[model samples]
Target: MELLDFARGPAMEWAFAIFIIGVLWRLFGIFFLHHRRDLNEPRHGGAAPWWGAVKTVFSRMWPRREFRERNTYSTVLGYVSHIGLAIVVFGGAFHLLFIRDLFGVSWPALPTAFVYLSGVVALVAFIALLVRRITHPVLRLLSNFDDYFSWFVAVAPLVTGLMAVAHLGARYETLLAIHILSFQLLLVWFPFGKLMHAFLFVPARAVTGYVFTRRGAAT
Candidate 1:
């Protein structure tokens, strides 16, 4: 179908181009920003800032003890969505095939059923997070258009891909085209949104940890 062709062709190419350029542009800006040297010497001896940075990145993966009670469910759902998305994207056979075709790299695929299960769980976990963002008093007060729009674009591909696979509500070709286009939407929005956090979170945590350690402050 012409629609499918366009979706798979120019739309995908343009979206991928925008994605790469935008992400590189942002990364270069961030990485090249001039950092003012700390004029003061480190306050804490044996703090080992580099080691602190590495440790903090891993440690921050889980909430601190005092915050665990209120954050447990939210944290669990976050991991569920993140892990599930990783599995579905990197381990699925079809996805791997796409990667192979695009970049000429190949890897072993997960079982099809497992990949589908991961996708379903990811969608559910992400939706739960979205609901919390909408209903939680502080979160809702702080939320803006970017938050909601990022969620929409991120979820669209997952929903459409599942629908396309299940042949729900449309012809196979049409559904496939919709799925691809939805993915392109995600690509186009990824670098310009909170979705950029996907790439920045690790560095952010590490940098914060290093700074806090050097100042002998609790993270």
Candidate 2:
């Protein structure tokens, strides 16, 4: 089969299926298998576990004062890069069209020009992050194969996409197929790697907030 057909056909199907199943399995395992009875009593009468979780979800979006003071630039850069990537993935016209085609759901999309700009910025941001990981003493010491692998998979789609858009390398069809295939690889990798943090962090932060609330402390 031609590369394009394979990428868009069976490869896409299997990658998507694995992505969905893996993510669901991980989530179910987290919620079902990890529960243990809290033997200890709440410190402050245990008033609002669920409410605390909800509150923490929004509260922790902004960094604490100490962290903000220390890493203000890094934090802001992270947010901008993340938000830019989100705009490209979730708000781009082509992306939204694909979402609609797959899920029968539709939403307004951002302008194509903006999406393109955000894509460029996100590419730069991820490159910077990878450089930091490689160069920083502590991060380099702690890094492993998963770190580099995840970065490559995360960045591959964007690089191929930008190349396709710019018509800079191979034929447009080939570049586009590479872009889609890279994204498929990303989907397959997402649940198995640190990328799972995208989904897992919610429950984790919520539980942390719940504990803090039980102690009568603010999240």
Please estimate how well model 2 matches the true structure, expressed as its whole-model Cα lDDT: 0.85
- Model 1 vs. true fold: TM: 0.95
Per-residue lDDT over 60-103 for candidate 2, one digit per residue giving the tens place of the 0 to 100 score: 77788878885666566677778888888898777798899999
**Candidate 2, residue 219: lDDT:** 78
Error of 2 at 186 (Å): 0.4
Superposed on all Cα atoms, model 2 deviates from the true structure by an RMSD in Å of 2.0
Q: lDDT tens digits, residues 1-219, model 1?
A: 999999989999999999999999999999999999987678766667887888899999899999999999999999999899899889988789889999999989999899889999999999999999989999999999999999899888888888977889999999989988998999999999999998999999999989888877766
Question: In model 1, where is the ten-residue run with the lowest total lDDT?
Answer: 39-48
lDDT, candidate 1, at 54: 88
| Cα error, candidate 2, residue 190 (Å) | 0.7
Query: Which regions of candidate 1 are displaced past 4 Å?
Result: none
- What value of lDDT does candidate 1 attain over all alpha carbons? 0.91
